[model samples]
Target: MIEQTKCNAILQKEAESFRNTSRRTFIKRLAGGTAVIAAAPYISCGKAGDSFEALKESAGALSTGNIGDEAFWREVKKQFIIDKKLIVMNAANLSPSPVPVMEILFELTRDVDRDASSQNRSKFSTLRQQTREAVAAYIGADPEEVAIVRNTSEGNNMVINGLSLNKGDEVVIWDQNHPTLNVAWDVRAERYGFTVKKVGTPLKPQTAEDLVEPFRDAITNRTKVLAFSDISNITGVRLPENELCAMARDAGIITVIDGAQSIGAMNLNMHDIGCDFYTCSSHKWMMGPREAGILYVKKEHITDLYPSIVGVGWEGAIGSGTARKFETLGQQANERIAAFGKTVEFLDAIGKDRIEARILSIAAALRDGISKRVPGVEFYNPQNREMSGGIVKFASPEIDLSDAGSTLYETYGIVCSVHGGNFPGIRLSTHIYNTMEEIEKATEAAAGLV
Candidate 1:
């Protein structure tokens, strides 16, 4: 590990570099001389300020090769305000925002509360655009193709309601998709007289083709849309999204990907995936503020899809001929939107590929540790990292699911998702915030339940 003083110096240097780059980008965006002067305070201070300096510093201190070093990750974990007593492994459902993101959120919220005047709030417009651009660049999409919506549900519905489906048209989806992408389609199909088919994959997939073939067989001549999750939140199955999207595209079908699980946990490029539409929530794996999400609409389909909400600024948004039309929901929480950009910056500083590798490592460790210690353990998720991401779902026949979940929390201070009914197991979705030591303790706790 680098010395503390030297690390601090490196962090400060990186932070200054980030600030300079941001200033240049902001100034370039506002090319008008008077507009730059008017936006100077917003640029130099609150909007493009030091909100993410701590995050950048922490990430910059670590060498690229030190991604697997526990010491370096421990420093990264310190950037979050999670309770010291609790081990949070539920990044699929939600994640605690890091200190930098929360700082920006609180700072902006206080600013809004202090002065609700239009003049004071004008800076948010520019900040929102910056966030849109950041999200676009992060996911490898054009700025005009990204919309800052409320959450995955809203993004899902935007495409669900936006598409022009008719009777005899079929939409093929995975059975494991979240309700927003699953039931939402059924609800829409009921009204429109369209068909919604749910396809299921093998319980234990051996290869990527095992997952892709099922969806391939489900599509037919009448299939107009192919909707599925990049990673199933329940079973932790990572689908062959690029192949699936390419298949749908070749068949002249629109592909809608619910990226609730994969967006932050994995490194993704929307263009490479070749999906017509993609949706994700920031609060889950991105660790941004709640109720903030992103909607990606392919530029060619921008005019084809209708806007779900037509509130204030609908005319200009429509006239813009971009994905902005999908974000016309009025009276948004501007503070949360601004903080979402900070969350992106935090992830970018750490590097998405490194975060993905760390997440997969912890997941594999937890899975291996549990399977070795606990007898007759059943894993719902795939063991191979190629077919999985950060999620690991398992249950022992001897222990009740609810009791195991409660005991894991109450006795071990480990918080994970518990499922009942059809899938009775505990789901542990780890992230960069988690440590190997915590996974070992959790493994012991699971064994004790037996």
Candidate 2:
């Protein structure tokens, strides 16, 4: 274990670099949020006397080698509070928070419950803006361009509602986009009388060019926004966002991307990504609170797009009005949302570059293990590492996987989820905390089921 406590310090330093870049507006919101965190009661993770020992303990744990270095991953496993009897392979559904994030959650909840101040009431908005600043930096976007939403559904809704196209305008969506996001567009399209074009993304495309052509082919004069999941949750395919965005830009079409699978798992820059809008929930790979999500829109589009829920003066550019307008439904898990700052801090500690590399390393191992175990496992995502993110989809031809997937966890005490979508499979996802051993264990059990 390598004590990246040094790395943690370095991460904070790097995060400080944002101080110069952050908009004055986001800084004010974050400062207010930090003040709230300061007033919050301190919940001891352990005895006060154990602080040094805890540091030493953490230092000892950090000295571990590569995650697959079996000895190292075992210790890494200790930070989580998962059921010892059950193995959790389903990070896609939700990941268990590590000690650090949990500690933050515990403290924040205590403060919100203990105090009745304007600070706590207003801090929710501030915390979200701060979180967006960090996330936007990680994803290569400006803080002003980002809005903290509840989930991918909410973020997607912002884009769907913001778009000001006419009744005949068309938007492109993949058949395999997450149901919540895909359906949001469908519901709005019907209401606004716009055309919802389902571009047929093939299960296994030969190359990046092949994977993107479906959307390109569907473009028409009325096709105003070309949107798709950054990486389809069901198929586990990483779409070419920059390429598609460039193509759309040439045609005067805007681009919207669902980063549910891509955002935290991969290092994405919104500006470099060439998309006009992007949406992702923090819970999944970001490992933040479930109801907290974010939306990014190009600065120019903010004025053009309107908020869905209109009431009580909701106006500003992207994430304007402290992003309060989008919180149409009132009084949220305020503390949980604030705790998202801690999640971002942890990720910042690990380094987004390290995390991007770490999760993909685990994903590759699972892909190899699943393929070797079941030759007939349908590999829907692009085989190229660059074309996939944290998700790896595989279904056995010899077994009825749709039904068998649920059993993979229930019987084996391994946690995972089954997908019945464009490319049916046992959708296996992993995050920073997931080691190769767990993936191997989950794979072995999955192989047995097949």
Candidate 3:
């Protein structure tokens, strides 16, 4: 039971007090607040009938101050333990758990292990609902519209395979898509004889419209779906998902977005972005427990998307029916899922807007340092700070950039990908824990190639 009475009573009271509180006034109050976190451009959670813009603004980082203000993010950083010898630059792949979420995960898991059916039955169900509600609210979505999946691949697969399109339907993807997503669409296209048309989306994109224009140009009368990544793990260029989704909607195309990199790193307003489907890997930017993922399907599209995994409760009514139509049958890791709630709690506590700002700011600083310090650096991320994401990949042909493994292993002790492909370079990812000092050292180390 959710204690609906108490929650309703609180909302009612908050609503009565806010009878005249306008969004503008609330925002102004946020800007003037004396509390350190509340003083940021978008921190405070204001009013009831809650929408995400208040929260989204809270997710933005401090644009005007020192990065990682100790009084600010040290507590946030205390939530995680870093590998002593390795600086994690592979957040695009995964993230370490925060202490709060880790503790919840460990405890909940033990409880579930002790007794699966009786103890965890309602508890697991409650976690799913809360997780869905938190994520939905994060993106301004209806809680009933979200589904908890395992990863972006699984979430995307639900929409890819769930779409009512038949053989010969056209779908669009880009060269820069993560393999997990690319392969899922490919599998569907191959199985159903649908045409999968993928085009070039460059690393240093010309413009959001220009980058998306390729996908638009590939569309024909047969084009039914436009699928793409919000940011490429390979290139780290953030895509204009909303603008492109609107473009596709104008063409009567269904949109599905691979948000593994975008979800926790950027300000994601799925409603504003207008995608029919958005999927994320929680372990990445969210630092949620491993194997936890989130999927959002437009409410109208729910009944239409047949569940990818069927179980005892799946085949019932699809739209609002448990949303578990996506759930896998058999036992699940109860502890890890419980920990997922703590991750949301932690993010909520710090505020999403601040997190978003902090990440982009840190990334932009690194981008600037790399661009200025390393002449050998081939800049691939977007020039504008807004388009920049947490990932910044650079390559160099000069000197022995060949020592990537030893360079990270022995010298700087940074653990990053070679970004390993044509035009290969180092990928130094920075999160809230990463300080300006560390960034300077990392850039100075990379500048060594010259």
Tens digits of per-residue lDDT for model 3 on 327-385?
75456775566556656766765656767888887788888887888765677777676
Order the candidates by TM-score, highest first — what do you get? Answer: 1, 2, 3
CA error at residue 231 for candidate 3, angstroms: 0.7
Candidate 3 regions off by >4 Å? Answer: 1-71, 315-319, 399-402
TM-score, prediction 2: 0.82
Better of 1 and 3 by TM-score: 1
lDDT of 1 by residue, 1-450 (tens): 244555455445534533344433543433221122222222221122222344456667777756647976776787676777899988988899876677567656655675678866777888889889899999999999999999999999989999999999999999999999999999999999999999999998999999999989999999999999999989998999999998998999999999999988899999998999999999999999999999999999999998878999988999999999888898989979977887787888889988998999899999999999999999987888888999998888877775777888899898888998667788998998898889898888888888
Clashing pairs in 2: 1-62, 1-63, 1-64, 2-62, 2-63, 2-64, 3-62, 139-268, 139-269, 149-293
Error (Å) of candidate 2 at residue 277 is 0.9
lDDT of prediction 2: 0.69
- The TM-scores of all predictions, comma-separated, are 0.88, 0.82, 0.81
Cα lDDT tens digits, model 2, 311-425, are: 4434443245334445555556766666677667656555566568778888888888878987577777866877888888877778686568668767877777786744667
Better of 1 and 2 by TM-score: 1
User: Model 3 reaches what TM-score against the true structure?
Assistant: 0.81
